[model samples]
Target: MKKLLCLLLAVATVLAMSVLPAMAEGAEINMFISSPEYADAVNELIAAYKEVAPDVTINYETTQNDYPTLLKTRINAGMTPDIFSTTSGKEIADYAEYSYNFAGSPAAEAMDPAVSAMMVYGDGEIHGFALKGNYFGMLYNKAIFEEVGIEFPRTLDAFEAACEKLSEAGYQPVTTGFAEWWVFKHVMQHFLDAASDDPAALVAAFQKGEAHFKDYPVLYDNFFRFIDLCVKYGDNKPLETDLAGEDAAFGAGKAAMMTGQGAWVEADVLAIDDALQIGFAGYPVTDDPAKSQIIGGSDQALRINKDSANLDAVMDFVNWWYTSDYGKAWFCDVAGVIPPITDAKVADMQIIQQGSELSATDGAAALSICYSSDSFNQAMGEAIQAYIGGTIDKDACCAQIEAKWVELDGAAQ
Candidate 1:
């Protein structure tokens, strides 16, 4: 009876979501975004905007793989977008000169204090506001767990034991999308962060060329453990699977759980079976609970072009984004996105609830992007793929990644 009620609620929630109207107004705003990860949610938000404000058009453009370079090129060339998206920390510094200051807006005021601190710069100027804050860890199928008779695992040993049981029960223990560079990088960040005594300090040293992955035996061992998790229980030819395939496989109950996934996978999973119950938890990367933490934090932000002719419309949208109930509903209820507003309502979705609880605990770290570089992340990801593909030993993978970090540091000098 309880399961039936939950399924009905899920069905009704999807039904209540509004689709954007087919027609559009004349003016179109070119909005440059870094990735297609949030494309669907952004589109839904745009559609909702069109219904009330017909004249303002939002044309979404993605640089995808070439986002960082193209964004730099465009910003440097002064070919500014009417609106753009940004990530936390130094990433926003590149576009700070051209981004409009949101010093006194509702959006700025509503931002979480810590996240707001990351956006402010010279003279206390605010350059961007977080559009979505996410938690990344282990996303699992609740139904599979019930069948396997295993509760959530809070330690590495227990997690591995559950994986073994799930495998013996004729279910794939875990599903991963190592073929996708970002997915591999995401998992590596989680593993390395959990393995370190002070992930931030270690990463700072690595960034400064004072330390390397090989310098931390914990990282080296954990990297292999991560690989082992995928190799032992991942779907056949795991390296061949992409993000879409991995999500679909888990949605179809091919796997009991997926590590390194978070709230982002909820919609994809529920789409396959509205009745399927899903849950999320912190990745117990170590045997000791004190050291384990789920990777999460402010993932994306929104900024406006200081010189765009549509500043009024852009500002209007920005203000409306936080001040209006429609914006909150569209983001939280419709898109299942947790905006950074301090007053935002908690979504009734169970997986989101789980992520929130995990994030609030002492054992959670913000996505540690500030400590690593793009070159270093790419090298580590490639090495992990190679290691999992059976071409490189664990030591070779760690050594090459360390060498790549040193190489990247030298080139930066």
Candidate 2:
């Protein structure tokens, strides 16, 4: 009887050893992405994930400057992060060779359709997911507009008038972040939407060398006019103003309005003054108020490397981040971002709430900037900067931009 008991105990010990490895499988994931604005929130996410996945370790890294160039260098050196990020639409294809298409994965299924629409590769394969969906528009100080006694403008003429009124009342009318190259893409996309009923097709036409800025009155005239008004009533050092400068000016109540920024700035601006009333509206594109529609959808996409040594672990982390209760809540409660997944609660911030209301009431324009590669967008920004600095005439700017469209994007096609 004693011998029989020993045999049973040995069998139980073997079964326990087998179950322990299965339960405590360990892994490490390296996640490198842009938008360092969310670093703290992402770190919080990693901490929470540690609770659920005690054996998994995520090495998180991010940057705001020259992210694409650095990412390319890593890819070339065969040191790709387990997960990385790029712009969602056109760039998904640019990095498709290295990205995994987890089309039917839990995370992909939970994604908001508006965001997932931008992540598609060939034949409905989903190659990316977003940290947060986004909204691009003008952010203004509600207190300033109230003090000036004018409603937020919805037409180009009214916008100019509002600027004049605000200036007359001792407030800088606008804060343009002209120093950042990505700012041009944010500001130009609204004009691009107004220029064509189908902005994507129009952008594609320009890439194919079939469209010109001169051909669209909205692009050539009204958009430039709007830029001029912002400059005329803008910062004393408009060209020197980066996003931090813009935020400092606007947050200090010195500037009434901000451009080339969206929901992301709300937290920072409010951190300056929690009681500040913030207002959001579309850019004044033309004579028609309806043409001024808020633009919504994710522009940045986070992609998993298909060839990662720890692919299953990476997938599990993403799945939990997207679908779990704690993860869904973290987007709004912790990150204060527009949740990238459907049915998630919206952040209780002014820009996010207003952006949602405006998009619902007036409809949103497509995120046209996502249709072009960032390489082309960066070149376009430099040309516009030259125009702004008086080094190049408007016509010369257009010429340079058109040539670049063909030279950079056209070749890709």
Candidate 3:
């Protein structure tokens, strides 16, 4: 009788939780997207979900800035979105109801807890579903490297030597779109992973304000060393150059080495030239490989509406994502995101390989970009751009971020 009662209650709970349109009034659901690259991939996922319930319209909006702040502004304006994304480090409790909590969801049971933890917020409340993960490393053009005779960087010193060597070879080496600001993020994270053997230690430091501008001089020194190379080899004024321009350098064969995380940009690089042989290598490890901590994690995520008219459809979408063969097939073939399911097969993902190989060394990988708050991100970008443009010296560059750190509530890290 007890077992029967439990089964009855389970069915009743699922029924009570999902308010289908037939039972209640429902209409268009808006989703605020934080990433633009995977919109095509997301559209595919959404199309699959639509088959489960075709009445709902997906109202989507894209933004490059902090979506959390946007969420706050929208809420303040009396406009509450039905669904949105809330990253682990940037959670706001007011919007909790609008997110999916993976802890108790069927979606959570089908995958690794760590990946699910990527979307976790509040007191173990999961806010989203993290799909494919990302990693940081160097992207070298095959033709450019071969013509210049520069091999991928294996060690810190070796990378620096390559930077100097590439500069002398009439090749623009280590180009970044500092003008776009986020370009510096991945490289900084990679440098942190190399210098601090503990990936979580970096995350822990960021949360506790223990890391500083000078805590790891290697990043400061090596990054500046790289910036020096960029100034010498750039096709034109690098200060005015943006990520689009930086990408053009690689595509046009004007630059040799570029840093990237496994984001949607992979598609663009692959599309540029059929013959553009691309090789990816982890952030330059320290002299000792074991000490090289892999610093990156869950690439991006999909969240749900807390007040959805149909919880079943949302859960259906998430469950299908990990368990259904059709969902997995689309993700693998179209999106290239390795679903959380353990037995899920993944293709030759360069970023995953970079992080996985490092993990086998008995270390961890935390997404490097997760280290700073939104304000720190902008400040650091400004500093790097100023330094490259010669408007700020090394001391001024360091001081700029230090001052902004104090201004911003990010104590350190």
Candidate 4:
């Protein structure tokens, strides 16, 4: 297999000159962003950044139109942008040997430490900076809670009993769009993490081939419970419903609850029902002491390319995102993103208020960032889609994950 990052020097090849004029009078800088999810927000930020540095041009692209392949080719050709995201968990570690520290770097200190920590490499150096922080917990229908005469579930048994009641009343217990592979996997991982004490450690063990889901009965049981619930309560022909449809189903009051990140609660769903009385609770733990609360990390991370032509500008933008109050407010207020910057607060957002309250009393689950290699996510997604579709057996689905783990290990070696 060809190595992905610029791990080994490639044969000399002609490369395109993609660099744009920099913020400085004579410098040329081109900023390339890799996530499709943040393309609009990033462009908006770019517009703001250019107010101070009009000469600099921001070159933006999501992970779209085969850009991943194009990016790999560019990196190999040594035409890599001045600043580019590593894109996925696996890619971040490929260059870990030469990672930089944003902590002491002028751009980082303006933000809160907790958000900063998430951006650092395992070796404690910051390669990425927090664009913003986010909170991820369960979004439950407050109206449903009132109608059912139940409070948000705190224990695993209570959670199931609530599901049972919801099912009895013909109310879908959970709104899931397994049809969309990423949404399916994200929720599954959230449930497992919400219930686990050491989510990161458990995933690490699985990554190293030291553990399997079956080895963790809690994981297996939850997996079964989740799928069973889906079978029981999902909309008719749910396997046909796409992720957006799932969101619509839940947001439009077609479903009672959704296991999703906090990011979607206010922006996506609330718009559909402004009167929607929704509450967020941390992932429930079957085993009491193991309960963890989660505020999902922002998908927005900032990275500079090893070959970047305008490192200063890229770093400047990253710093502004964390340090500048205006920047923080856009993400928190307009976008409803939680600021990782410690002191930043939004007094008005209802979901933030709800999440802050839940987390305040240890009601939140300390959820881990659910990440592995890009291939790992893809493989898990494939298996999940297959299982949900009933096109594969459970053992077969587990086996697929194990196989992919070995495949990634071998390639990395």
- lDDT of the candidates, in the order given: 0.74, 0.92, 0.63, 0.64
Off by over 4 Å in 2: 1-25
For model 3, how many clashes? 6
lDDT of 4 by residue, 1-413 (tens): 46743433342222322344224564454555555666677777777867866876666666756665776687778777665555324455665543345557656676555445556676666666555556776778888877888877756677778888887876787776666556644555665575456766666767777777787666677656666665566667766676577668778887887764465446678778888877776666454533636554544455666445566666676677666766766676644556666666754666777766756676444334434665566677778778877898888888787777666743354
lDDT of 1 by residue, 149-197 (tens): 9987767788789889998999998888778766766776666677565
lDDT of 2 by residue, 254-287 (tens): 9999999998888788888888899999999999
**TM-score, cand. 3:** 0.78
- Candidate 1 structure lDDT: 0.74
Candidate 3 global lDDT = 0.63
The Cα error of candidate 1 at residue 259, in Å, is 1.9
Where does model 4 exceed 4 Å of error? 1-26, 34-41, 54-67, 87-89, 95-101, 111-114, 191-196, 285-292, 363-371, 409-413
Consecutive 10-residue window with the lowest summed lDDT within model 3: 86-95
Worst 10 residues of 2 by lDDT: 19-28
Q: Can you give the TM-score per candidate against the true fold? A: 0.81, 0.91, 0.78, 0.82
Q: Report the CA-based lDDT of candidate 4 relative to the real structure.
A: 0.64
Candidate 2 local lDDT, residue 301: 96
Candidate 3 residue pairs that clash: 133-299, 211-413, 294-365, 296-366, 296-367, 297-367
